[model samples]
Target: MPLNKTLSVLLLSLISGGALAAEAGTAFIALPGKAMLADAVRLAATVTAIDPATRTLTLQGDNGQARQVVAGPEVRNFAQIKVGDRVEVRLLESLSLELKKGGAGVRTRVDSVEAARAEDGSAPAGALARSTTVLADVIKVDAKTHSIELKGVSRKLKLKIDNPEQLKQIQVGDQIKGTYIDALGISVTPQPAK
Candidate 1:
């Protein structure tokens, strides 16, 4: 066989096996304090309290871990978050958090928040009035019920699909955009789009 053909076969085999295949090498996992301050860490916690004016959030993990997180202006609307509610947050380099809700549990301060508005075109002010946009990667897909498992920042989310056909188009490696609405409960609508 030609060299290129041989290489393609090997690559195909690797992808078919699994993306996170066990390898013979030293793998390192860092704990929260062990990592540098600039490093992003995801923590799942319950909202214990919220200081609206100060924009500080107090969260307690299901296992009893706790931390205070700050929300930035880019978050748009932090006032909607409530005490005793669950939330997932992405921490930016400026030490600000982007609040995301509707996951397995509450997650906080794991990564930077991308800008909400599209850069290619201008959006009318308040165009995204009722919803918050999230960029997440699909971690798991359930074809049976048309639900998808997503990982945003440090939190895992299971989103229900309004259009089963749209869900069918999603693959594990696909990236997704989710719209989150806050009401008596947090709800997420994720669609498979570039």
Candidate 2:
């Protein structure tokens, strides 16, 4: 997907009430189009602590508030999550006691999850690497201007060929990897790594 399109989808999700917020005061806020927070919630948090025996996790928010959450058997190993690692928790169901006007019923539904990185690292889209570089595959080659249109796994990129010699060596279906300085330009020379 293109970055802009992905961002648009995310924004639409947020605007349509697909996101939820939980505060330290034990209050949950729901966004617009989706179900209630207790209805359908999408929360992002960090793992502060974990108990493998109990299958529980102590998650903290960016604001420093913490909550005790339990994981199901589907979660293979709690050890995979480290302390301070950001995690996205989707509240699928809550069986808490609620006082309603008519009657009481257990709540069960599906929700979304969004996780953020704990610290900034030089990794391509969260991959493990010391130095990361953005890459794009050539989608279209303009022989006239010596420019190429490329698309990555997550974004569409356009690159200008300052060196005609290097551009002559490139062709359609070629993969290029380089440091992106701007939308249509590269800071470093691209090489065929893959």
| Stretches of candidate 2 exceeding 4 Å from the true structure | 1-42, 90-194
Q: Give the CA lDDT, 0 to 100, for residue 98 in model 1.
A: 25
Supply the global lDDT for candidate 2. 0.42
Error of 1 at 52 (Å): 1.5
The TM-score, computed over Cα atoms with residue i paired to residue i, of candidate 1 is 0.27
Candidate 1: tens digits of C-alpha lDDT, residues 1-194: 43223323423332343321221222233232111112222223456777888777666655565566554444434555566665432221211112222233322222222223212222211111123445666678788877878777657789765455556566675655544332111111222245
- Cα lDDT tens digits, model 2, 123-168, are 1111111122444566777988878776665667676665566566
Q: How many backbone collisions does model 1 have?
A: 0
**Model 1 spans with C-alpha error above 4 angstroms:** 1-42, 89-194
Give the range where candidate 2 is weakest over 10 consecutive residues by summed lDDT.
Answer: 180-189
Q: What TM-score does structure 2 among the candidates reach?
A: 0.27
